[model samples]
Structure formats: structure tokens, C-alpha cells
Target: MTSLLAILIGCLYAAAIYMMLRRSVVKLVIGLILLSNAANLLIFTAAGLERGVPPLIEEGQQVIAGTAADPLAQALILTAIVIGFGVLAFAVVLIHRACEVVQTDDMNEMKGTD
Candidate 1:
């Protein structure tokens, strides 16, 4: 399962880089989204995958009894997701306004702001 996820993450990163290298502004945004997703997956994979175990410890237990999910990783991923969403929204709005003003979605054409 982890090997599969690793392969998937690598593909995502490749796609993200490809998109980011494109001249289209929309593709750049898509790439950014893909990059963020890949990063999240990387974090998840690094934290390791556990089965049938809760992330929290028992009320009376000083520590978890056995192998359990890392709560910190989960929280980090959640926070990253929220931040990614905000970045996506901001990028979309910025792209929209740029397109409206510049009358083009080509990054090359947008360079003539002067």
C-alpha cells in the first residue's frame, strides 16, 4: 500500500512540475494545487500508516498501548489542507483579475505591466 502511495505521490509531483512549467496562468494554478496535494500525501506517508488503531491514548494510560496513528501528522495535514484551500482561492481570484486587466492568460503577455 505504501509503495503504491509512493508511486502515486511521485506521479503527482511530476505532473505538478510539468503544469507549473507551462506558459498558461491557469496551468500554474493547477500545478500549485497538485503540488500542495502531493506535499500532503508526502506528509501522510512519512508519518506511516497504521491499521485499526486510534490516534489518541486511553484516558488513564500515560501513553498509547500499541502502534497508533500520529495525531501530530493528522493535525499538520488538516492545517495544510486549510492553508492550501486559502492559497487556491487567492490564486484564483488573482488570476481572474489579472486576466480581466491584461486580457490574456498567458504568463509571457502578462509581463508587460508597464
Candidate 2:
């Protein structure tokens, strides 16, 4: 599963880069979102995948002393998701404003000296 997930992440990164290189502002925004998702996935995959065990510990235990899913990964992913959403939203807004002024979503067309 880890190997498969790793491959998936690689594919996503490749696609994201490909999209980012396109001549469309919309594609660039999509690529940014993909890149963010790929990063989150990489972090998730780096954290070991374990079966669903509550990440809890008894009061006397100094730590979670069993096979429990790491909460850190979940927390990190959650934070990334929120931040990614905000970034994506901002990018979209910027794109919209650019389109309104430039009258096109093409990167080449957006380059105006005036």
C-alpha cells in the first residue's frame, strides 16, 4: 500500500508540475492545489500507516504505549487542508481579478507593458 501510495504521490507531483507549466492561469491555480495536496499526501505517507487504534493513553502511562495511529499526521494534514483551502481561494480570487482586467486567462496574453 505504501509503495502504491508513493507512486500515486509521484504521479500527482508530475501532473502538478506539468499543469503549472501550461500557458493558462487556471491551470496554474489547479497545479498549485495539486502541489499542496501532494505535499500533504507525502507527509501522510511519511508517517507510518497503522491500523485504526485510538491514539490514547492511560493516565499513568507516560506515552501512547501501543499500536495506535499517530495523531500528529492527522493534525498536520488537517492544518494543511485548511491552509491549502485558504491559499487556493486567494489564488482563485486573484485569477478572477486578473481575468477581469486582462480579459483572458492565458499567461502569454496577460503580459502587457501598459
Q: Rate the local accuracy (lDDT) of all candidates.
A: 0.94, 0.92
* lDDT tens readout by residue for model 1, 1-114: 999999999999999999999999999999999999999999999988876478677888798777877888899999999999998999999999999999999999999776
Candidate 2 lDDT score at position 41: 97
Question: What TM-score does each of the candidates earn?
Answer: 0.93, 0.93
Candidate with maximal lDDT: 1
Q: Where does candidate 1 clash, by residue pair?
A: none
lDDT of 2 by residue, 39-72 (tens): 9999999998778678887898887776889789
- Please report the TM-score between candidate 2 and the true structure: 0.93
The segments of candidate 2 whose C-alpha lies over 4 angstroms from its true place after superposition are none
